[model samples]
Target: MMNDEVIKLIENRRSIRSFEERPLDPEVLDKLKRLTLRCPTGGRFSVIEIVDQSKKDKLCALCENQVMISRAPGVWLFLSDMERFYSWMKEKKCAENFGESLNKPGIGTFHLGMQDAIIAAQNAVIAAEAMGMHSCFVGDIIENYEEIQAMFNLPKYAVPACLLIFGYAKSIPTSPLTSRPEPEYVFMKDGYKHQSVDECEKMYEKNTVSFRERGVLPFDNTGSYIEWYYRKKYTSDWMAEMSRSVGVFLDRWLSDEA
Candidate 1:
């Protein structure tokens, strides 16, 4: 079901942050856009490419000052859009109840939209990598919900799902492939399998050690890498801010008045 070229592309793809200071070839960019559109969608979603320097700069700030936003040739924002569908329904004089259902979507609708957006994003990244280009997914696009919505002039049912910045890498990445847990640890047989606290710790220990060795997490004499990681990442200010933003966005996006 898989070929060597496709397998190699998947294996070698990595998140590239440092990009060369240049624009992508117009033809190549156009081809990439076409390839991305071929990705599966649940009948709603849109991809917007941002090339304006002023807008990119504002986006960089909104995304917690990730300099890669400013360095990349262009950024693609994937939106979970129901506005177009709503407009069509209005023009066709759809039933009031049917229109109201779409006007006030629930959590399941959000999940479907987010899944579609992310799937399209992965397709875009893989296509870019195949063409000798690099890309990184910016989940932080959802951090400043209100500001981002206003900046993009998004409609009520349209929400920013994710961002992918694409460009040529300045140099090859030197980092080794990151390790993952064993298949048994993550992949359950037929149904869900809940692990105990100790089991969870064991599964994560390898990654914790690797992070410390790579100097990503400062090593203290205590040698509790997991503890350090939880404090540094899970409990960080940015994580809290992102959580708050998600809640606020959900409230507004799913509101009947939205």
Candidate 2:
């Protein structure tokens, strides 16, 4: 069984949009940075803590005017950074021994970097919660890769992995926790289990009911909650842009055009 304090902390975690008009305590910020760095990683990750209001405003615009970006007192951008590692290896003559083909980053490197950065970001989230702060993830930060890369002057080996903002919540949330799929459907016994459409609907019944109650489902009886979300988020223009942006960034990372 989970510890009572751990259970309570995980259960209470939620995305916060509204924050009080104040900065984080200096001691808390120091601890937050330390906690973020302590997470496991395959390689080093870079973190950019945004304190400059001008940069925050630009980031807000880049993320499709998510007003919360501007309002949050603590903003951070996490990167799957290989440039620093590559430079170190070069300085130590280790990278030069491998030659260009073996030294340049590949798809595997990118994946590892993303894992390291995202893990660090989650660590920051949990640590912030423990310190009496709230946080929200800004996934749209991946939608404008070129502009963001230019803004931060990122190298080809450093890709944006996650953007997180933290602050003290203005009010406690009263809404129920979002529903999740049943354990049977999520955890397989041995192999992949493919369910029929009816089974899928059954599995998502709780989500459908919750969405309907919150008025998130479409007014016209066009489709189920899953279909509505598929159209609303999965196939949205912003998602397409995110795909395009990431493709561009990947191409640059994989290119040999030093």
Candidate 3:
């Protein structure tokens, strides 16, 4: 059973983008770091803090000019790091087979690292929220992969997993809570089951209605809500660019020939 405080914290959590200008207290930051360290990981990961104004500015540019990144007092870059393990293997004179195991991490390894990093990031977010701070996850870190690698001087086996910006929000949230689809739509009791088109539409109706109310659809005539979402998101130029970046990142970081 979960405690009331914990349930309330989960229910109240929101993605905060607007932040106050003041910096976070060092003690609070330290506590957040400690909390993040407690998160479980497959092996290990690295967390880099960005406090420099110039780097924050560059990051803002790299991440689609999302000014909230620059505004946040604390910016954390989570990385999936296999380089540290590789170094340990080298130092200990580990077998060549063991060393070669991660020479070029495949999809399975990539997923493990990504999951580890994400769990840590979430821990950091919850910690910040607990301390009366707010945070937003910036998935755009996937873009400009080469520049990020060069900027951080990352080793071949280390890759950016996500970005988290934390600070005090400019104001308390006044908007209504966002709706999520029912568990049956996503959670399966047994084997995977494919949802029919109509079933999918029914499941997504609430979100689609919300989007329509927000006037997000370009034109009112844009077929179904799902179609409008697909056109706006899946077929967008930014999505294409992000896809290209992912391909390039995989080639550079996980190429067996390298």
| lDDT string, candidate 2, 111-137, tens digits | 888999999999999988988898999
Instruction: Sort all candidates by lDDT, best to worst.
Output: 2, 3, 1
Q: Given candidate 1, what's the lDDT at residue 33? A: 86
lDDT of 1: 0.82
Candidate topping lDDT: 2
C-alpha lDDT of residue 215 in model 2: 70
Steric clashes per prediction = 0, 0, 0
In terms of TM-score, the best-performing candidate is 2
lDDT of 3 by residue, 174-214 (tens): 99877778899999878899999999989988877878787
Name the TM-score of candidate 2: 0.93
List runs of model 2 lying over 4 Å from the truth. 97-102, 219-222
* Alpha carbon deviation, residue 253, candidate 3 (Å): 2.2
What's the TM for model 1?
0.91
